[model samples]
Target: MSSTPGLSTTKQFRNLLLSDQLEFICEAHNGLSAKIVQEAGFKGIWASGLSISAQFGVRDNNEASWTQVLETLEFMSDATTIPILLDGDTGYGNFNNMQRLVRKLEQRKIAAVCIEDKLFPKTNSFIKGDAQPMADMHEFCGKIKAGKDAQSDPNFSIIARVESFICGWGLAEALRRAEAYRQAGADGILIHSALAVPDEILAFKQEWGNRCPVVIVPTKYYATPTDVFRQHNFSIVIWANHLLRSSVTAMQKTARTLKEQEHLLSIEDKVAPVSEIFRLQNAAELQEAEDRYLPRGAEDTCAIVLAASRGSELGELTEHQPKTMVKIQGTPILTHIADAYNAVGIKDIVVVRGYKKETVNLPNLTYVDNDEYAETGELASLLKALQSRKGRAQHTIVSYGDVLFNKYIPQSLCQESDDCVIFIDSNWREQSRYSRLGGFAECSIPNSRRAFNAKVYLKQLGNKIPESNTHGVWMGFLKVSPAAATLITTIITELLAQPGNRKATIPQLLQELLKRQQPIRVLYTVGHWLDINNLEDVVQAGEF
Candidate 1:
């Protein structure tokens, strides 16, 4: 554990941070530190919140100066070869400021950033002698939309961090925020450390992971192996602040080593080899993967729903804003979808706008303004959307913008041979506290042979099972094949083409599919599925 009083520029460190092999982050405390980290054989640099907050010499509040953050980001960008993910303290302010902050950061070529639910400079609720209130949920969601709207590259990762669990809020509250952030357009949910590593990992896996991919910092939380995380379907796992941990650990140990060992030479054996470190930094030629398939995605065929913080799920929470404007746990739900899709590779996306559109700014995402949005359902809003694809996905995904769920629905349904597939959860029950307060309820359906064409159990619409099990509407996710999408479009277009004819909702479209005998499949998602529709639910959605 020897150092020139700093992190080493060794091949091993480079390999860990660079090569995109591990999600380990080398944290840069300041602009000067950013350069040191990069030169010290690191691939990516993390701008930390706690460290940076301490620099301000004031308690963390939701009121840090933007100038400090902006300048620091600029400084970090200048010192690194790898991308720097800034810790955007609540986007440095409200919706407008948040937009500007993200744009400025993206312009700097920083690869990623995080927006926590903590009001910028917010004191931790869990930290003894540091209890404070956070930003209102609605305001925070707007901040999330603002950040997403401001980014140019859809791949530029935006992590929505939820701090409720760590800050004195209960578990139910935390889960509710996780659901909201997923719905709000966040690329992922960044849950903070509740305690030491193992307990934190257990919390993450148990709490709404099926809704989205969970990102974690092992240094502060659980110190489990990667394989354990992979088992729970965590798409991206970052061992955040490890470089910081190592740096400090080395200093402490080396000081003791020198004091205990009469000869400095005895302490030298603990150091990692220098030559191995340079190799990881690629001091030689960078090998090109000539045969590796250029990563391709099926973005060409689909509907891009330009989303806004919409509906009543936010209620008074969004009275001054939109539902997408409210914070889930810590981040807005809107940011969850943006990060989740971009991470796994769904780049071409459309976001239909209604409610408050000015609060969000995103590039490569087609925004369709819904003029009659208040009078129409998602199908009507979708009907107003414009597709860039020549033909829709043979498997088109009709995603609900305001409802937060995971991004894995596409992959799960893609492999299915069924002409039509719907991602469904058996938890489709009557409205719970979160949903009822959110103002949206899962649509009910008769659970019988009719829902599924079963030789094991078949019955006509009128012929019901004597003791049937009933499952209500979904958690708001769909993976429609092109044929099914086209059919739904045709069916709706034909119906709506006639004045006074009602457009078919997603459920209606499927009901018709049942009558038409189209083969349909449902992938079970018994995880958290809250229909976020109001302010009460905005804070309550997935407690169930």
Candidate 2:
């Protein structure tokens, strides 16, 4: 549960109900949607029962159990500081159940609950409007009384949802029930109507005289202007279920379009970006907490960028600087790589520089000179970097400096719990920029039964792998766990000692590891990376 420093959530909700000006709340079905509602400036949340049940793919008729609703409430309460008024359908049962629910809701810091005057396993008010019978007024009043008695917090609210109008009961019965509920200790009365106008609600308000604060759900009559509710001095107006409705519309459209087109090119820009999701999930907070609380050894993840080559294929672009230093959209590819690493909390970045090594400069980086870079390959530069670090890194990310990738690639790779994991582009065959020269990987087929734990192993990794046997092209990025780092350091040291392997590349090193029966997992991605291998590649990378 979350709260403001000076005011409790219950008290805040009570204030909203009793305030002179009208207050509004939007409906949310889950934690993420609840937080979004709060972020949208709503002072409170209406945890709509219909929306919650729909989210579970169940009917609004209490097909989802009370415990399930409580669990969802827990998440909604924890995700936001705003008060939540849960639509507790018929209090889940009688007075005993209402009492227990009140206790549990108070424990979870939910501000209030609105239980409609209907039988247990209630149907939605808008559905079969005149057919659903309202619960006995005296019995529901007792339920409200029990809930008020059970609440330990003084300000916890119990709003009685009067469904008399929906049941075709006259305004007189609605007023009578409202007065009885007020006498029975309900904090507010939420008068519901299925009419296309606010006439019934206004008529009830005119006679009831706001004996207790009146709440309104004009969901059926949304065409009515807000000023009408304010004119009648309605305390709260609930825009219930719109968020879930809008989300359903969006998801359906996106799903249908993607299914028809069999691709995301048309729909990608219409939806939220992955980074937006990370932001809403507060992922940076967890990363900050990990940095502060995780063990020093566990946090000791570093990056080794094999950036020694001049990328002569890029023509005059590398005349004065290394290929990794070439500007892409006004930023160096190495800087972009470093930024990607930094985004995932890899601060200990080491760049292996050789050609124009003096020209490569970046803040907060530890440079390792690979003077033999002109004669050696990526494996030799990696060897030099590993030898300099002396295998202290708990996890190491080795990436080609000229490649630019989405931050999610490294973020996803770091989550793998394997000895060694390589990023592979499964859509490699469709890419015109890639050729036989790029490193290809052959991975064991993933188990179809265990979707969550379906691990794909690297059966072979090298440029020499036949295209027919290859699963994907390696993206020149890989992560090594502590044991894998030690094993790699040892293997590279021994291989370099036998000078014949001096110019071995990263794929060659991976192939050697595979030959020794080392288990290397594969993290498959489609294509969110750019490999700047030539002048055309450089132009494409500029747009990346």
Candidate 3:
């Protein structure tokens, strides 16, 4: 458990759209902030070398005293329950320092950490006119391998952050470094970029989406929409320092008001009341504590799958029926989605009907009519179903209607203990052999705070669901809970506030999560998958 003040700080930032997963890793900021964030329900904590160096009003250098970093890690980890990941700038020294830093961070019980490929006193990459060459790929990989071997827990992730993109090393250098990092047993890679176009980001994801999960910060360049990244399969998009950004803006506003008005109460309208400040996070999630009806048992978990419309995207084959209905060896894709959950013994089916609802009906099924389905994505249909359920289940499963994958929904659903879990394909390896459509859908969860569409959700798995249960999105399958249903409903309704043109896609909805920092459970699916997106897909379906 976290301290009350720390939890409250977590809630406060989350209320302001700062994500708990974004893990505020500051180089110079107070380590106490770590305790604050952990209490706020953040999944992890971060220590940034850049910010830490700036704190002394001195530039960061490769020779940054390791004692300071060690002390920071110790204090932060000792104060929080969540994992603490530190930014070990250039590994504090060399291969030996890298080894020492690994031991030091673990001694503090830090969640995970990273060491960048940069030289001494590395000038800020984001600063114009500032440039530095990255370390040799072989050497960086060796350091990463050393760190990996030092890790005691297999799940304790070690990220290899490549600054080649930001350092103007170009894509070739970045990719080369990324490959080296992955080979070095780096569990993940964060492609540091102070400047990146949408296509470049997509290219990066296309190139290395499957090699290992890639992470990024949208605020790095302040360019590219959330949808573009979603299409590319860039797994982790940690929203960088919005709290500091907002704090700066708010402070300036207050200063201007007081200076101009000649009074501390210069402007009242500019000041947001507490009610308005924490509405999205504390106001809403806290409401769940009161209105949220605690379930009596595990029976509250429900499995849901929304079928995609039959479109010419599949060509003349789907001209009569929907794509989900298009037979796969005489069995519909919707059936596969159902069977995924059926394998787990959960037969309560909730289908969101849109373009040809009557064509996919089954016995004992609950149909959630999405009259706007043709105009919206699977997310809209999910919203309608959540409203229909009125937060009925303690947990729920959600999946796209057109997916063609093998899964064991019940077992998967029972594995996680979060409010939302996304069934990702562990084998969803991308290749140029495919078309230029959406690549593998990467799990770029904003954090465990931002509100997201019902296409993903959480459900407590503490209760027994049996060893035979399989949670998969094969062809189609997903699960969630009553608590998550309510949150998603709120997210959908909030999306309605956005401009009409942008509210139609789930990825667009995901952007909203970036601003909201809602929590989600992203579970990788260890099953086969095929998307029925276009005519070629129909050809691909036959092979499946």
Candidate 4:
């Protein structure tokens, strides 16, 4: 439903290098950290080998295998929208290893890799310092050539990372290695230095003659400004290890404070709110998957909305239209309701239609005609729609056509595992039409240990409505689990057979299910709902 253009992150990364502007990339160890880096406004990500190894509480001396690092990079690629440049430490092995690494990285949509010219199972440069062994010139160049040959995308970069300074080999060796790597078809050169300043890195960029793009990892020389890198014509700058390191410090401090105070309330205000965490974790997206793939009769994901009512009480609003067909802000009210469902990834929709059924057409929807709309209630229309899906769908959300609520309501409903779940508005008295409707039925659920995951049992169902002591009013959204489908169908049949309950309502049907001792629960979502009945209700809903 979105019209925004898609971006090839690989091409965009290559373009950033081709452009004159310097690219400042952030480092991440996992998917969530990568997303955090992106959210902080960085242009690209660096999948640091050290950070990934540290994540598993291991040293960064090839302790974590290449496959483990590759898996981490894959998660980063999927989580963040930007390109990732992986720290391919010593290419994991020989030229053969380098070739396989390139192939795997390209498959995961990684934009680039920076392979250091060090022996296999190399130690961390910053820790080992001055004692690390550099790989043979011919051998390292062969590895670079192999990686370049294995690259699947023309834009995929293979940057040769030179550790001459780290190995105590002079600037001359670093420059020589840079030239050899460039000749060996490496897309760029990353000159690494463990010094407290960028003097050696800046000198390398100057002497290298800009033959290829230059990269710098200023971990030790953190104070070097971006303008200095731009002055030396460095193409990319990686602030590697900051995110993982900062996270550790923050977590440690929080843990210590919690231990000292023996409670979390003191730190609650300082920590990230629960809502932000849910948004970052893509809770809504997860619920969409739950709604689509959970099996009911055949497939678990499906829903039905009863839109057959003519809403005769709305005066001219339904003179020749069904209640759902009436427009709110130039869009059909039913479309708005359907949009809420679609937003949460419920695409298999069934709309029960009667009055002006021809005008209720929408894409990707199945329609069931309720010719008895003038003679039946909403429950009858729902029963007609459920016939086609009797024992199949894993879960079904049945909602009234005359109301509107936030997408979160249905998203929460899909995430719940209850056999039968009902939605309620605890603050329904705020509605403008509350007084006019002469108050709805009260269904109170008490707060007791027995009430937790309680089996709701209705005492009776007829002209006398079931009363609940709970604070909320039913909002007409129900989630029916796969195991309850047959029970619901049988109950509908039995209720229809009884003369006194021949025209049973939705609440009445639910009450009958309760009497049968069904496992039922309630979800209370308060302010975000609209139940349009008359013109006054429409005006109030629009204002809301």
Best candidate, TM-score: 2
Better of 2 and 3 by lDDT: 2
lDDT of candidate model 3 versus the reference: 0.60
Per lDDT, the best of the predicted structures is 2
lDDT of 4 by residue, 300-401 (tens): 457789899788999888988888988887778888888988888788889999988888897788899998887777668888988978657468899878
TM-score of each model, in listed order = 0.40, 0.61, 0.42, 0.57
Q: What are the Cα lDDT values of the candidates?
A: 0.58, 0.88, 0.60, 0.80
- Cα RMSDs of all predictions? 29.1, 15.1, 29.1, 18.7
- Candidate 2 residue spans exceeding 4 A from truth: 1-5, 297-300, 303-544
Clashes of each: 63, 0, 57, 17
Sorted by lDDT, highest first, which candidate order results? 2, 4, 3, 1
**Which of 1 and 2 is the better model by TM-score?**
2
C-alpha-based local distance difference test score of model 2 = 0.88
| Preferred candidate (TM-score higher): 2 or 3 | 2
- Where is model 1 poorest over a 10-residue stretch in terms of lDDT? 456-465
lDDT of 1 by residue, 1-544 (tens): 1122343322222233223233445667666567667667555677876556555654455444667766767766654556676777667667897788777777776677778886655554346512646567767777777778887776666778877656667667777777777677777677776565656545656867556556666655455777776566654455454555566688789888888876768666777567655554444433333213333234433535435335664456666655654667777666666655665566666777777776655556666776566666556666665233435443456666666655565555545555665654545444323221122222224345555543111111111212244333344455665666666667666656665544335555555566777655655555544556655556664442
